[model samples]
Target: MTNISRSNYDPEVEESEYDRLERRWTEQLSELRVTQAGTQIMMGFLLTLSFQPSFETISLFERNLYLSLVITATLATVLAIAPVSFHRILFGHPGAKARVVSITQVLLRLTLILVALVLSGTVALIFNMVLGTTAGIIGGICAVVTITTIWIALPMTVLRKLR
Candidate 1:
């Protein structure tokens, strides 16, 4: 069998640790794309609610709740999309790893919050339109609980285990 030279196999122009971080950031951006799409769609739908015929018929409290959820969705969409643009602007900076990691953590938190808001909003909206106060409250609670479990609890548990 022919043997390869170590220097040839592992080139002198090897990637620095920062290049590894940049690669990881690229991967993280790809993953965030899916979440960005979903939240943007949800925010779009939330925006259209004001023009709907039924929107005027809802109680003041429900209207306020709907508005709050829409704001959350909008914020979430922005946060989710921040990292991509942030990297583009800060690509060559020496502090890329620190910035990227900070942005990633913030995006994750925003995503979880947005997930809860969107889920609760959708559920509460449906119940408000169909089954009224009791059902809306119940549905919102259920949605929050689900988000906390899958988004917050599960990730925290896995991270804790890793540590």
Candidate 2:
């Protein structure tokens, strides 16, 4: 009937702080690699849109949306790569690995938000161009909802359950 305390310590998989940090950094790098590739590709596509012959024919609103998407995508790409730059600049400094990991986690979250916006905007733009304004708005809203549910809500729910 006595209280028992539970600890996360697992002797079978012992890891030093430095080793844990290294593993986290490695995993973060892998995630960033994937995100960077997608963001760059999206940026490239957005950049090429203006050169198309039909680009000049779009409404002002569409043009503004496209510009915003381009800017957001660029920001996302920069954030996705910021972790690597931070690590490079802080390399070999004491406690730098932990700092890099913390910064990387923040950057990654921001990048994901920007990526979601870019994706939703892209869908809106395409729908607006092909269908109508109402369709475009609906598509964008649906995209946002779906992304939020999958990316943010799902993780939060799992974390809450774990806690």
The lowest-lDDT stretch of 10 consecutive residues in candidate 1 is 4-13
User: Top model by lDDT, which number?
Assistant: 2
lDDT of 2 by residue, 6-103 (tens): 56444326678888888889889999999999899999999999999999999999999999999999999999989989999999999999999999
How close is every model to the real structure, measured as TM-score? Answer: 0.78, 0.89
Local error of candidate 1 at residue 137 (angstroms): 0.4
Which regions in candidate 2 have their CA more than 4 angstroms from the true location? 1-13
Among these predicted structures, which one has the highest TM-score? 2
Clashing pairs in 2: none
* Tens digits of per-residue lDDT for model 1, 68-155: 8888888888888888788778877888776876788678667867767887888987787789889988988898888888877999
* Segments in model 1 whose C-alpha atoms lie over 4 Å from true places: 1-16, 156-163
How far off is residue 125 in model 1, in Å?
Answer: 2.4
Full-model lDDT, candidate 2 = 0.92
